[model samples]
Target: MALSGEDAGETIDIVEPAVRMGSYLAEVQPVEDAAGLIFLLWAIQQPTIARPNAFVRQSSMELRLDACGHQITIVQTPSSMSNPGVTGAVMWDSGIVLTKFLESAVDSGRLVLQGSKVVELGSGCGLVGCAAALLGARVVLTDLPDRLKLLKKNVEVNVKERNARGSAEVCELNWGDDLDAELTEPPPDFVVGSDVVYSEAAVVDLLSTLRQLSASCTTIFLAGELRNDAVLEYFLEAAMEDFLIGHVDQSQWHPDYRSQRVAILVLVKK
Candidate 1:
């Protein structure tokens, strides 16, 4: 099947086969000169290929923070891919982008991290949270229960060993669940997330947790990959009821770290 759309003399076509034996391919093509359009071509499956043993091994990912003059090492377990339900074991592009954005914002004086209380939701691999802590923000890195082991290890290796200016503690924070006093005793000055808005079913629960974590003076920054338009739309629509949402333009992003497939949004409690 083929789907197409047009805007301002630019057109895009998404073509995919209606049926396939072991795998499928989806190709997105731009018919006109859409300068900023991003084309994605991906395979849905590769049943014939053997599973690699590397997928079950743990790998170290190093992210250098020029601003902090240090490198944070994150351990990524690709084995999580075997379990379709697991997403936090790997480092995603959105997480890297958000971490760099935070660095840039703090360096530019657009954001202040010194002694600020920050909370990170769905902090996969704890990259963003560790970055925040190194920038002098006392940060809480939270995720589902099963994700805490790896998250804690990352934080310990990067933040604790380096004796960063601030601190980070890993915690279990299932969305829509009762809020822990440690998370809300004083209400976080900022709540941040990356690649957390990927499903329509989780939107409501995510919003509920956001609402509970935020105070009237709180600010939220969320960075996400633009993979599912419907899921993002649903989240934004529901969030508007209690937040004043604003998109962070690409021009405002870090110069060396940006992508057309990723978006950053700022939200203030309304």
Candidate 2:
């Protein structure tokens, strides 16, 4: 629940509201495998759902994450009951981890962000995409059309007017649907997503989109909270058939913020 960076001045603490408890149940104790991990996360979440809260139509918050000497500021919409299913409006811990990972990878020269064409799927609140743009990648942040309003606003505030080599743009992208024409012709060099794998149905859709967009040269990164073992297992099983997938080492990320409840995966065409 704490995102600490390299410097003493760089640490940023985020306090999750009672209404947003569903998204903040991370950092649990490690379990044996994916199944046990998922069950433990599920068990932790059951009681929090029984609470109640007032409706918040709209509000904004600023979040700062420091990693690899880079301080990234994100403008986001905090969780609200008015728009129940619009998960993209809020900032989740998995997104924070992935954003920091991108910065760390770029700083370590393990990944290239400068002048790369990058695409972010399920870019809720656009934090990860904004981080990518700040690292000099031309980033396209995509989500369902209904989610684009808030997603676009976040991108506009955080990523606009930057002198970074790459700029951020918002686009409509429904997983499992036909690939958008603009996205296919150039094929992004890198694809990324955070906290996107949650349901069995969405796993199928997400894999289909990845297949359509990826080639032998493309690299994909996905970060997800280990909140559902069955859903996570389904995605890994299906993705392994077409793309080589492996868990990213926790040592590669900032030590202060890494959590066993979250995972980052690297994927490439087989």
Candidate 3:
């Protein structure tokens, strides 16, 4: 992608486990060091799932990056290596966890796409929020403490001044945690989520948090990747009580990965 004011390979690579990895050199605009930018090269190469099974035990390769302008020289993991999660960076630093469903929801224009005052929940690497901000939406990239740190840096690093003058913000947001106090300011006009619901317990907290944020007449849009039939069932059961579910289906972003179809649900005043 061409980052404005930056040429190709402007990214700064953070270290991953693999050696003999690829590298690149490019020009990058200065950015705030404390900004929550996820390190350029951290992917949850471990099955891309939470649980680790026999396959999980196998070694996994990690990606290395060198940013130049907005272009990055990324080295895909070789087939031989495994286990890139040694740094705990993968969980929150991975890119495009569920781009297919996310893009679908955003492109649909079904919700109140004010393109202003938006907050994202469980914004792992903040890709979705970044995309929203790119669409002229002022967005907040939020997750846990550690994750927020990197995410904030990413916003400063990746976003150009031309994009709403870098209107994106990053903060700590934990589901099942405070939804009110967590919002640094007044209620946002819109709230978005992606791949936040998969577990039984997470679904409860996710819905509870979504419900809490649902008030204020703020329209909310969520795109999730259900791992299995059970998780899908739980999503329906929990969401049915609070949200008006809409469009659901399976889709893919790239030919390599296909995120399961999702049901779009909008929070209505109860």
Candidate 4:
């Protein structure tokens, strides 16, 4: 078969690996034999360029997780790598752990989800907030403006069909910004975030946002991946100055889903 519209000799030489292997044989070749070498080069080189892109175009995937006997369906981007800078694009292990913990807590009567006003910070994929809405809490899932689209889509798909007792809303919440006038009137009774403490620079802003929404009776739950020791340590140290922080034992979560790398911390306004 024809390799390129270009000359066969030039094409064969351009394929470095084929040329090296065929160099000795080429010395003995008649003019007609060059076409055989050209075909071999074509066969080897086509796959390298013809292969489809490994990363799929941006799209949402539906994932099913059973929490508190309720099957939660969350729609989110398949891979964070597909869209960088949007940590909120995918569901994380910390979010799963937190969601399971919330389900268990509500079922055991340790927490009151019913009628409680809840706000979630950096609600990546909106899994934790959707779980809260499933459990009967009036939930607001907040993220940076750029992240709101995916977060809202997840909330819509997961929370709407459940016919949940509580309603779910999506809003913009930039940590450290003045609490929006609407978010202030009825201060949230509970503040929750999953895997939100990834950056040292954002810790102060996160804490400020938490402090703004918190009152004496408000409780905050922050679930984070223990991947970075320094970042986690810095958050705890800085947050201790303003809030009483305590770790929730893994034993408190569903046995099957417990993980050493995931931590859920409860913070009360001090």
Which tens-of-lDDT digit does each residue in 98-141 have in candidate 3? 33333344445432333557788887555556656655667877
Please give the range of 10 consecutive residues that has the lowest summed lDDT in model 4.
20-29
Candidate 4 global TM-score: 0.75
Poorly placed runs, candidate 4 (over 4 Å): 1-60
lDDT at position 185, candidate 2: 70
Better of 1 and 4 by lDDT: 1
Of 1 and 4, the candidate ahead on TM-score is 1
Per-residue error at 175 for model 3, in Å? 1.3
By lDDT, the best candidate is 1
Candidate 2: tens digits of C-alpha lDDT, residues 2-73: 222223455322222212111111122221234332333344334234322111122557666663344556
Question: Per the 3 Å backbone cut-off, how many clashing residue pairs does candidate 4 have?
Answer: 0
| TM-score ranking from best candidate downward | 1, 2, 4, 3
Point out where model 3 deviates above 4 Å: 1-115, 160-162, 181-185, 248-269
lDDT of each: 0.73, 0.68, 0.46, 0.70
The top-ranked prediction according to TM-score is 1
For candidate 1, what is the TM-score?
0.78
Tell me the deviation in Å of residue 60 in model 1. 6.6
